[model samples]
Target: MAWGPQSTPDYRFGRSKNTQRYSAPPGVTLLGYASPEGAGDAIHHYLRDHEAQVRRGQQVVRAVQQLINQGITPDITVTHPAWGEALFLKTLLPKAHHIQYCEFYYQNQGADIDFDPEYPSSIDGHYRSLCRNATQLLSLTQTDACISPTQWQCSRYPIEYQHKIKVVHEGVNTLFLTHKHWPTKSLRCSIILLILLTWAKRHAKRLLNASTSKPLPYPSGLI
Candidate 1:
């Protein structure tokens, strides 16, 4: 879904590449910005995170504006709000339908903050976690709809926004997720796996993974 949108049925995505120089694929266009550090994000403060997101949103706005200037206006846009790209989008393209790729939402309790028995959530910690969600809430408010990977995750958003979220699995890797039978001796042992869904809980809420970092361009509506 990252690179599937196009007027010509081609896939294109873009973002900051390694400083060592890079090359794009045969049919892909690199329509992104090379942010200073952590895509202009910092882990030191919550306000900085929102600023970083705004910076990214500015990059996206410039890219889209350029496209419009060239007679290519997008009818639909998909973005990840964890980094703040979606914050200023609706103002620029109010007519374009925006869809946010919903993921993990941060909360003081009933979530990962207190999931660990070793570290209990504190008032300060809760406040920080809540602060982390500022950009997400703003993005959610402006977005026309949302899509999450699972029902449980989709339910993480505020009750008023739940109606706009849709459950759409990106699909699992059958090669690693296929069912298999284990011997009785092997079953005796316990296996605990920890999966990090989004960077909200990590990096002080300044998400910097490929999913959030790379903002691709699409040609038109829901294509």
Candidate 2:
């Protein structure tokens, strides 16, 4: 089942069987109450940020409860914990094994904070980032297992949760990886060369990190 915005056609078309999509309630406000601004409002802003997540989490919990009452019990529930939907699932379905997709963890340095000097960091950015991770931390605690698309992504999580995360690629699009009959030989060769180059870089990075104390290189934000 998919639980997200109804505006996306993919979910509407892909929804099958008794699976359902539980989206946000109408006119609930995008991020809870009105957001606070300016330096003086930093603390207040972060409070609202967390409040928004809790509100969304409540909605998810209610939706799941309704589904459970309908006899639609699942043995395994796969969810992305980024938005707090997976927070209270374990409370309702203690017997069900929950596997959360660990997408990204916010960091103040060397990762998505001051990546570009042009876009300088905000004064309360660090605090906001930490508050943003509250939902993730809660969801991870409730989840039985976790999966990360890359090793680097898994490493971004807390040391406690890191042990539970398994690194696994979701798989690539074969159509994009392989050439079609329409493409010329030269184009196909170039594409293959690009792919090989990317693989070589990743391989080199793995070796370098393994031999040194430095960690595997990851993008400033989500890898």
Best by lDDT: 1
Each candidate's lDDT (Cα)?
0.67, 0.61
Best-performing candidate as measured by TM-score: 1
lDDT of 2 by residue, 1-223 (tens): 2223334211111112213334534532111212222233544776665666666566666656655586655566677777656777788778877888887887776665664464567879888877778878888889888899887778888899898999987767676777564546433122211222222453555434433554424322111
Per-residue lDDT tens digits for candidate 1, residues 28-73, read 5556555624433445565666667777777667766776696665
For model 2, what is the C-alpha lDDT against the true structure? 0.61
The TM-score obtained by model 1 is: 0.70
Which TM-score value belongs to model 2? 0.61
